[model samples]
Structure formats: C-alpha cells, structure tokens
Target: MTDNEALASASNSAIAAAVARLAEASASGVPRPPVRDLIGRDDLAAAYAVQAALTERRLAAGARTTGRKIGLTSEAVQRQLGVDQPDFGVLFDDMAHTDGATVPAGSVLQPRVEAEVAFVLRAGLADGPLDTEQVRDAVGYGVAALEICGSRIADWDISLADTVADNASAGAYVLGTDRRTLAETEPADVVMSMSVNGTEVSTGTGAACLGDPLAAVAWLARTARAFGEPLRAGDVVLSGALGPMHPVSPGDTVTATLSGFGSVTVRFGTGEAA
Candidate 1:
C-alpha cells in the first residue's frame, strides 16, 4: 500500500477506537479516559469524524435529531484547548427537558450546569451569508436556557479533540418558557445568574458567549454549512455557556435566570426525566 493509503487506514482505525471508547462510556454510564490520546489534540478533523460516527450510530438506533449545540465559546476553554474558534455537537431528542423538569438518571456522567441562551430558528441558515444580521433574521425567538454538560472523560481531563470527539461533552438541556425577540432584548446585553438548590453559584452576561449569542449562532451556522450539515428552521441552538459551570449530584436542583428573559429550572432525579 502507498503511504497515503496507510495513513488513511491508521486514521480510520483511530477514529473507530475512539468511538468505541466513548460509546461504551455513554451506554455503561462509566466515564472513560480522554480520547485525545487516540485522536490527538490538534487533529480536529479526526475528532469531528469520531463525533459523526457516534451521531450516526445514535440515529441508527432510533434517536431523533433535535438540533445542535455550540461549545468552547468561552475564552478560558479556548485557551485551554489552544484554539481560536469553537466546536459543536448534535442534540438528540432524548436530551431535551422542559422548564422545571427532571433529568433522568444515567443520562449523563460527571454532570455540570451552565446557563445559556436558546434560539429557535424560523429560517434556514444554509443559504445565508452566516453573519449576525443573517442569524438575527433567522431566529424565531430567544429563550433562557440551561445546558447540562457532562463529560465521559474521567475527571474532565479533556483536550480539544477529546471533548470534540465526545460530542462536545453534551448532556441534556432545559429551556425557559419566556421568549423574546432580538429587537425586544438584545442577546449580547443579557445578564445571567445560575443557582444550585437556592444558592447562587455562577453569573455572567451574554457577551461572554462569543461576544453575543447571536454571533455564536452565526458562527455555528457557517461552520455547520461547511461541514455539510446546515442549520434549518425549527432547530434549537444552544449558544454555549455564559458563565462557569457548576457540578451537580443526584437530587440537586439547578435554576438559571436570564435578566429580562425570566428563568429555567431542572431537577436531578433518581429516575428517567420523561
């Protein structure tokens, strides 16, 4: 075989190995080691390949695609990963929870909570220029949201590729009922406060998310189209976390308040969230 063929074979092997490790963690509810050792930290393409394969398996298993999630929008995580941009993951239908709902047991491992803004799209992003203006026009409405982040990597000792290959460490999410227009309340100016069991633990503003949640959505739209999976109407986009994420245990209740956008709450329950 030629050198190029050999290299491709090795890459395919690595992607498969990483997928198996992550899939086992997801199914068995046991955290695995970081996948960067298999896919490497800088090979983002290979990392996303693993994610795509995992997403395929879930779809084949009857999991319905809900939307997509943006991750690593925070500068701290970017610095940690040595990257300038962000990454994304697919959100399955089973990963959604309504406001004041419970998160089913084993839905995630090493779970943490962060507040964000959720946008439901009314227009397709595939044919647009993918800018803040285009995203503004595409957005149906904005609502306060909480992204329940969980890591399959034990202790969350993850590199960029590790998290990317692990589907951006996505868990479940809860969205608020109150919706606002981009004209009514600009996302970049929104303030966020997150509390765990009545004690405030994290705080931030919309600017923390790639300068603005709308900007983040624009970035995701551009990236997703580049990857051949563009954002479409009715998609629920989680525009990354606005603040530090706090850990949660069973029976812990998380509540996040978005200034001028009301709040969303979720409970960590012993049984299934449904």
Candidate 2:
C-alpha cells in the first residue's frame, strides 16, 4: 500500500481503539489512557471523528440522542484546557436527570459539576450560521441546569483532543423544573451560584458563558450543523458552564440556583445498579 493509504489505515485504527477505550471506561467507571497518546496530539478532527463514531455506537446500543452539551466556553475553562475555543459532545437520554434526582457515583469516573443554562429548542435549526437572536428565538424555554462532567482520561489529565474524543467529558445532567422564555427574562443577566453540601463554592453570571449563554447555544447549533448534525426541535442544549466546576463525591448534595430561573438539586449516592 502507498504511504497515504497506510496513514489512513493507521488513523482509522486509532479512532476505533479510542472508541473502545471510551466505552470500556464508561462501563467500568475506570479511567483510560488519553486518546491524544493513541492519535497524535492536536488532531481535533480525528478526535471528533472518534467522538462521532462512539456516539453512533451508543445510538446503536439503544441509547437515544437527547441533545448536546457545550464545554470550555468559559474563559477559565478554556484557559485550563489551553484552548481558545469551545468543544461539544452528544447527550443521550440515559444521561439526563430531573431536579432532586439521585445520581449513582459509581456510574462515572472523576465526576465534577458545573452550573449552566439549558435551552429547550422549539424549532429545528438548519446547518448554517446562526446568531444569538436566532438561537434565542428558537428556544422554547430556559432552565437552570447542572452539567455533571466526567473524564475517562486518567486523573482528568487531558488535552483538547483527549477531552473532545471522550465525548466532551460528559457524564449526566440535571434540569430545573421552572422555565421561562427569553422575553420573560434576560439570559445574559442571570447569576448562578453553586453550592455543595449547603455551602456556596462557585458563582458566576450568564455572561461568563461566551458573553451570553444564548451565544454559546448559537455556536453549538452552528458547529453541530457544520458537523452534519443539525440541532433539532425538542433537543435540550446545555450551554457551557457559567463558572468554574467543582468536584463532587458520594453523599454530597449539589445545588445550583439561577437568578429568576429557580434552582436545581442533585444528590450523589454510592454504587447503585447502573
């Protein structure tokens, strides 16, 4: 075979291996070697390919796609990841929880929590450029949300490609009961405070999420469209974290409150049947 063919073969192998590792980690709740090590570092396209492949595998395995989650939209998170832009991942039906739900700690490895604004889209978004207003108009309502992020990479040691390939380090999410349309409230002015065990730990505003949470959602819609996956009606989009993320442990109760949007709570418990 020619050099080009050999390179393509090797790349395909890496993607397949990475997908297997992610599945193994998710099932076993164990960290795996970073995909950046298997594929070359800085190969985000390859990493996304791996993410898409694994997501498809998940869909085939009976997991239904619910929506998408945006990550690294905050400057702080981007700085931590050493990236200038944000990344995203698919959200499945099994990964969703309602407010006051109990999440099994054993189901995820190295889990953390971040407060966010979630949008329930009222209309399907086409594959193309979308502005913040268009995104806002498409939203049926917004809710206070907490993204439970987990990493399959050992000790959360990950590069851009590593996290991107690991389904954007997504675990599960909890959504608040109360919801409001954009006309009823300002998405950019909402303030979020996250508390663990009844003690406040992190705080931020909607502006922390790429200036406005709607903007992040717009970016996600456009980005997904570019990837051949358009945002559909009824899809819940978890706009990136409003501030820094905090670690959570079993028996811990985490709550996130958004100004004017009410609050959502999640309780963690020790190993339970998946």
TM values, all candidates: 0.93, 0.93
Query: Residue 243: error of model 2 in Å?
Result: 0.6
Candidate 2, residue 170: Cα displacement in angstroms equals 0.6
CA lDDT, every model vs. true structure: 0.87, 0.87
lDDT of 2 at 140: 99
Candidate 2: C-alpha lDDT: 0.87
Per-residue lDDT over 1-274 for candidate 1, one digit per residue giving the tens place of the 0 to 100 score? 2222233323778888999999999888999998878778767788788888888899999999889999989775566446667889999999999999988776889989889999999998998589999999999999999999999999988887888888988999999999988879989999999999999998889999999989999999998997889999999999988888889998999999999788999999877444
Pairs that collide in candidate 1 are: none
Worst 10 residues of 2 by lDDT: 1-10
Error of 2 at 171 (Å): 0.2
Q: Flag regions of model 2 displaced more than 4 Å.
A: 1-10, 272-274
